[model samples]
Target: MEVDVKLFGDLREGRFEQEKTQLEENSRVIDVIKKCNLPLEHVAVCFVNNCQAEFGQVLEDGDRIAFSPPVGGM
Candidate 1:
């Protein structure tokens, strides 16, 4: 199975801003995060195919996944 992944903010450091990745059947959103070596605590939002999704959300082949890291500004 393959999915499109988008990383936002600091999450893109040393990683592709957007890319496709292969995964096993029944992979969840968290799996993708781990595969990207992103800290779970830093992830503030997740979207699948432009819809809000939870970490436990099951991923499907060709699904579009976007991740946003926590943001802060003064």
Candidate 2:
């Protein structure tokens, strides 16, 4: 299975690639993040195919995942 992925914030900067990536079948959202070495603690939000998702969410083929890092400031 192939999944479309989008990384935001520091993760993208670290990987230097914002393009979609293909992953194996039954891959979880956290799996992709791990591939980029991103810490879930730093993520503010995550979406799968436009719906809010969690680390345990399983990704399907053609699924689109997006990540946004947490921002802190007053």
Candidate 3:
């Protein structure tokens, strides 16, 4: 399946800001994270198709996923 992905904050520093990646069938959010080599600890939230998602959330073809690193300070 092909999933559209985007990264926010420092998560995209050494990686792509947005991309369309191929993943195995039934791949979950965490799978994509691993495929991108993102630091699991830094992933603060996930959005699938613009809605909040959990790591175990299943992904589908053409789904849009955004991964954001934790934001701090006030």
Candidate 4:
């Protein structure tokens, strides 16, 4: 079981390289975040398969997970 993870915005930039990760199924969003060594404070938005999902949501195989920071411009 594997899931596709897509990082966006500052999150992607912070990770240096590699925008995607294949994680085991039944893993929660938080698990991936931890595996990536990403700080919780840097996360502002998260989606699963186009729907807003919580960090605790258990990921399923083939799920598309997108992560991004809060973006604002003036």
User: Over the stretch 1-74, how does candidate 3's per-residue lDDT look in tens digits?
Assistant: 99999999999998999999999999999999999999999899999999999999999999999999889841
Off by over 4 Å in 2: none
Best by TM-score: 3
Better of 2 and 3 by TM-score: 3
Candidate 4 or 2, higher lDDT: 2
Q: TM-score of model 2 relative to the true fold?
A: 0.80
lDDT at residue 19 of model 1 (Cα atoms):
96
- Output the lDDT of residue 35, model 1: 98
Alpha-carbon runs more than 4 Å astray in model 1: none
Which scores higher on TM-score, 2 or 4?
Answer: 4
- Predicted structure 3: lDDT: 0.96
Decreasing lDDT order of the candidates: 3, 1, 2, 4
lDDT per model vs. reference: 0.95, 0.80, 0.96, 0.79
Instruction: Give per-residue CA lDDT, model 1, range 1-74, as digits (tens).
Output: 99999999999989889999999999999999999999999899999999999999999999999999888751
Per-residue lDDT tens digits of candidate 2, residues 1-74?
A: 77777777775775654556778788899898887677868777889999999999988888988888876650
Residue lDDT tens for model 4, 1-74: 66677777777664643345677757899998898877888888888899999999998877887778778841
Displacement of the residue 54 alpha carbon in candidate 1, Å: 0.4
Question: Per-prediction TM-score, please?
Answer: 0.94, 0.80, 0.95, 0.81
TM-score of 3: 0.95
